[model samples]
Target chain A: MAEMRREWIVNAVLAMALLIVPLVALWINEPFYVTLATRVAILALAGVGLNLALGLGGMVSFGHAAYFGLGGYVAGIMAHHAFTGLPMWIGVTGSNQMLWIWLWAALLSGFLALIIGALSLRTSGIFFIMITLAFAQMIFYFTLSWPAYGGEDGLPIFVRNQFPGLNTMRPWDMFILSYGVLMLALVFFAMLRAARFGAALMAIRQNPDRAAAVGISPFGVKLAAFVLSGMITGLAGAMMADLTRFVSPAMIAWQMSGELIVIIILGGVGRLFGPVAGAAILVAFEVIFGGITEHWQFFLGLILLGVVLFARGGLIGLLAGRARHG
Target chain B: MSVALFAEQLLNGVQFGLMLFLMAAGLTLVFGVMGLINLAHGSLYMIGAFVCAAAAAAFGSFWLGLIAGLAAAAAAGALIELTVIRRLYDRDHLDQVLATFALILILSEGVRMIFGPFPLYLSVPDLLRGTVDLGITRYSLYRLALIGIGIAVAIGLWLLIAKTRLGIQIRAGESDREMIAALGVNIRWLYTVVFALGAALAGMAGALVGAIQSVQVGMGEPVLILAFVVIVIGGIGSIKGAMVGALLVGVIDTMGRFLLPRIFAAFLDPAQAMGVGAALASMLIYLLMALVLILRPRGLFPAHG
Candidate 1:
């Protein structure tokens, strides 16, 4: 009975935090914050993607930004080609449509993840970390040197990719769309965690040899988790590019990858809606600190240091206290 | 590309690889000895470059600047190892990664505060500024000198590890920590000294490269990535492997940048060809690494029994 109340209160708190505040802000016409909230929401969705792998599966990937950038590029490129009358490729119809672009982004990142994960998963521990990082760096350098899109300067989407009926140019509309995606991602995350595959992933994360002995192919499970994780992150990236209307090589940079990891650490590793809280904290810290000081990165660094050293189990973990039973 | 250009690129690649080796050697050693995955290794590289630049400007001598940079890097390494890193020695990789990432932030922002946003240039000595004419090709004499210095350092490290008593302790520490501590070997001092030595090597690499490139705020970042690649390729924790890995990566990267575009130009328009080809070629080494890892998860040369 007490457990029921605890769960109810937690859900209520999360719903109020995620939905109520944003809706109130919208009604109040404080749309400036709505835009920022959307930024946090989309990035949080991306964090959810990573949390599935890193948090639940104990896979520390340093290359998820490659998928993120690939997703962004997919959005930007399809839009650019549609605008400029350039075909995506020969013997196939191109799409500048947001939904279709997202579909492609998801598929492309999933495929890339299959390759990266396949190669990287051969080595465990630090080797896995380094290999992922190296592959991401390769992609980053390629994006920087390749001038077809924009090279180091990044490409801007002059108009948001068309989303059927929505007027995405309006701030509130974009925020609503981002909010919708965040809900979908959260639901997907919850459903995924409840699945048998999720159980296998958790089992493998706990002990790979044990999982393998129990007839779960640790390799396949990990690879599948990694690919799904990439696809989710890719979806977020596709939306983010359109949100900011810009895509650059920096999207795939190692620092961006590290930032995602940082965000996950800030929230809580495997908790539901943890990314939402983490993104909120990170973006809020950025907004407030950035407004006050030009060199807010110094302060952000200090805060990050404090959290890493002192916070222990992140916001959710601190608040919830190990969820009573793992 | 001309033969001279090919040779020159090869030389440039070697130079890059050696620098990577210097950075990776320390990182791999730390990993091997302590099981610590440090992200602040890059910050140490930045610290090295910053100190080199500052000291060079103040002292008006490149050699003195190099020495000062080495001193600063070593001191920073020793201090951090003694205070925070020592505590983390027994912790897991995740904690170490987080702490080191934090250190990178602190060091980067601290340096930026001290030395504004503007890049500080490290001028090569007038004595080593000229080009060496290799009959078919001419390259910077300073770069060739760098290669020579790198080789000497590699040999010096080899001797220090193979013949010296310190090497035995480092090896023992890698194998077993508690046993060594029980041996009354002053294990703490050994760890500190090894860390400081690693920092000095990284600093020397930074100081040397400072002459060729503009020493900027975030200059150490790219080199940090390359060093990671080197260590990954050259089997983590092996000094000899690091030397070999550095040269291979350096040459391949340089050659790819110089030649791949021309090769693609043969097939496509010059503009698109150069853009696509150069990008793909830059990624080739990483692709190679991926393939290697798939085949041999422990890298080309694993360093354990």
Candidate 2:
């Protein structure tokens, strides 16, 4: 019980720090820090999306960036058309509304995940990893080929899209929006972990044959988790596109997928706040080391190697305790 | 297409397939023997190309450079295996993936720091630069030499794996690591040897390719991706599958590029045809992969019983 309390304390402190650091930055007139915090929150959201599959479900998808890039493309393509006053298809025009845009992004990514998951779930282990990666590469190449939408150069958003009451152009507002969404995602992730379906997913992860013996369909459960995971990632991608005001094939690239995995492993794979801690560490490293040298990634790789080899539990694990399930 | 053009593209496809086989061979061998999903295999390929280019430039001898590339890559492979990969033999696939992925970042950046950001040129040797005529068409001898090298390597590998005692130990290790170790085979040294061998092959492919294109950091990733597709289509841990799959992918990709544009031109406006055809052609390999996966989920040749 005492150990559990410590874990809770660590989790609370991490969450509060995430919130307070940005607010302090805003107060100190360091808007750049606020932007950094926003990046952490948005990336954390994407990581959480992946954690759903990787952590809880034991599905190590190397292509969450597909859903992520799709989400960003949705935002970029919509805003681009909106700016040009052009129709997206036959009769539908582009939307600048965040609510509608987020909904569509989730839907599209979920749909793609369904198709990809159906095919990929047929295989297990290394084959699954390669197939997910290959599918992402397919999307990456598709975007690169379409010269109409900026091709490899990527598309840019001239203006930030609107929210119901917030002025998203302001740095703090965007940060706040991203934080709120991240918090909501955390709550949803926690609920799913506690829910019955989460149990089924976990069961499948632990032992598929046993899960089958219990009458739970392993394929269905995994597929559902994959879609939900993709949707969350897609929503995060949409916000990320808004934060950067740009979307390119880079968003969907395999490197993006690798980065997402790095953050999850850096923080704590299954922990609720793992993404938050990871994104914080990653962005912090990027800032500090980036300022020091052009080859910051070399050091990042070294540190990451150390963590994977020695530091198994990540930041949350180091601070809190062994992961609950682990 | 003219008969000459058709023949030329056919040879190009075969040549491209051979290059892919070098990469796939290594990847499949490693996965089959070690159960390691190495993302940094591509980085080793990059290392080979860089070393080959730098050595050839310094010594002014391409042949000497090739020898240096193979040796350096093999040494680097053994070093990495001893230092990092040996620990990961027991870890899950995710850890292996992440560790190798990190290796790629470190190695690529390390190479960039050493060689700078620009690509280095590695010209084909003078002896292999001339064109060769075969019936209706002429093709570059350098490319044909690459094809010959790939075939020679393939046969050499087959003999090495099928005819040697080390090959028997390797095959035994693949099916049962403990049994081989129990039989007094040095499992540790065997793994190192296997890894080094795989790395050497990938490096050789990189050195060959570097003569045609500029040697640069991150050059191995695309080939690595394609190699992954090849192994998946061929079957993980199956050398025969890798070779067959490589050829199929190579031929299909080359032919798609050559034919798709013409097919589109026949039906669409000339200007539109070129654009749409190029786009579709670029995606043809992936589409083929997806189609194959749908039909054969375990791939065309799964190795395990």
Candidate 3:
């Protein structure tokens, strides 16, 4: 196919995969698959958030799981307190359930981003990566030790928190909530990419000193991108907690953060739909091979190594030939 | 816990530090010589423990198993260097991190698939199993023995690198990779050999530590983090830094964990004290790391010059 036609084909295929597949899965006789797809959607949303900082901004944060987990704990704690009859101070009429949970998740995650990014942004290169990882470890260890929550055992959501006119306890309702969040996150990603701030962020990633030479403050640009990236991951965490009806210290674990990076790579690094595609592949592999073999991670590792070694641009890069385009 | 308890903990801290040295020596050596970070160094450790455990079980000989484990791990390291890792020398750190991360996943799962998820135990050899009655206190003979072994290894490694022709080539490579290659040393062999040596050291650590702790999949991860911390504190490419940093971190971390709860209990209730104390203890080394980086970004013993 010609270049333009091939690009169109790639975009259409992705849309169909992202949109049509989930809807089809929802319609199918299997309730299990819809729920599975919803998990993918939520995880993909988290990855989309990560892709902003990592793929575009060139910040490989191994600490995003902190935001994702913290967002979860926020919702989990709020619901726990609310269920236990603690009166929330602000009594806005519509801000009763899911929206408030998500809003607070975004805000708290952003706040975390501000603190973590501020300290970490001081260092560059491998120092930055290790610092971020260490900070996340700090949070993880804190959660594990803090006994107010379930500690290592994790906190369970006995009743799915209420959403007006929606029975969120039901899997279908939960899937819709997660899918909606994923779509909104994707739109946010696209808009940010097109925005001038996004261009500036990209420029910072390419060469901060040079970008500064051109009068762009790399510091503020990176900080903004980090905050936005963190907030989105945070929202995904909230959704994840809702899906699982539980929150654990593991959500903030380095493994989760590393896995998020993995998804971006598997799909095709820096592509808009890369995270979604990557999440799809990972979740699908988990669902299928997990049933057949108990040790599927080994195979996943092999594939990942192959991708890193040979498929430098990732799956989408191979399919679309967007190296020069980028 | 009395002064004696503190003393024991100190010794434990030293023992742990020695173990960390064994782990970090190879890692630092490989990284120092070739600016490539190998995330799978932990996997090599895991491989060592697994091999030793399996071999010991089959042969009813712990010493033989340990030798087999070391050799297997070293061989695997060499193979990996030749097949996959050597190519990654020129690649960026992010690429290296990802690829190595992938290897960890593969290794842990592979071990699990083969050996099952159950943790394996390797009994200590007859000579090293008992405790030694020191003048001041009783100590695990094996632990003391490990300290001796670590010191010996450190000396041997120093001599090898400082005295031997191969060691000179490695030193030359570290100083200048392109120039060393131009001078007719087989750079690839140096890398493969260094990688193998590192893998062997890691395997030794795993086998030794496996005597103390159960051998399980993903066991290498925590050690890997600490090794990273060690390298960071000591300086990325310095052997001396790894040694010093490992000891400092081991002592500080152990002391912090043991002492913090007591400090906190004076100010708060027992329950809150434990929680706060543990959290602070966990954060201490990291806090130290941040402070060190702030003061000296190249690390405490950077070999950059």
Q: List the TM values for chain B, per candidate.
A: 0.97, 0.98, 0.97
Q: Each predicted complex: what DockQ?
A: 0.71, 0.78, 0.57
Q: Candidate 2: where are CA atoms >4 Å away?
A: none
Off by over 4 Å in 3: A1-9, A86-96
Task: List model 3 lDDT by residue over A35-61, tens digit each.
Answer: 787888889999998999888888878
TM-score of chain B of 1: 0.97
Candidate 1's DockQ is 0.71
Model 1 agreement with the true structure over B119-172: per-residue lDDT tens digits: 888999888999988898999999999988988888888888878899888888
The lDDT leader among the candidates is 2
The worst-scoring run of ten residues by lDDT in candidate 2 chain B lies at: B270-279
| Poorest lDDT segment (10 consecutive residues) of candidate 1 chain A | A317-326
* Clash tally for model 3: 0
Model 3: clashing residue pairs? none
Candidate 1, residues A1-326: lDDT per residue as tens digits? Answer: 65436544664586567666667888998877778888988999999999998888888888889999999999998888877787767955556688999999999999999989988888878877788888989989888998878989999888888787889988877888888898888888888888998889999988899999989999999999999999999999999999999999989998888888888888877777678778888888888988987677777777777777667667777666654313
Docking class of 1: medium
Best candidate, TM-score-wise? Answer: 2
- Residue-level lDDT of model 2, residues B1-305, one tens digit each, is 79999889989999999999999998888888889998999988998899999999999999989999888888889999999999999999999999999999999999999999999999999889889998799999999999999999999999999999999988998899899899899999999999999999989999999999889988998889899999889989999999999999899989988998899999998777877877787788878888888898877888976
Q: Give the runs in model 1 whose Cα sits over 4 Å from its true position.
A: A1-8, A91-93, A323-326
TM-score (all chains, Cα) for each model: 0.96, 0.98, 0.94
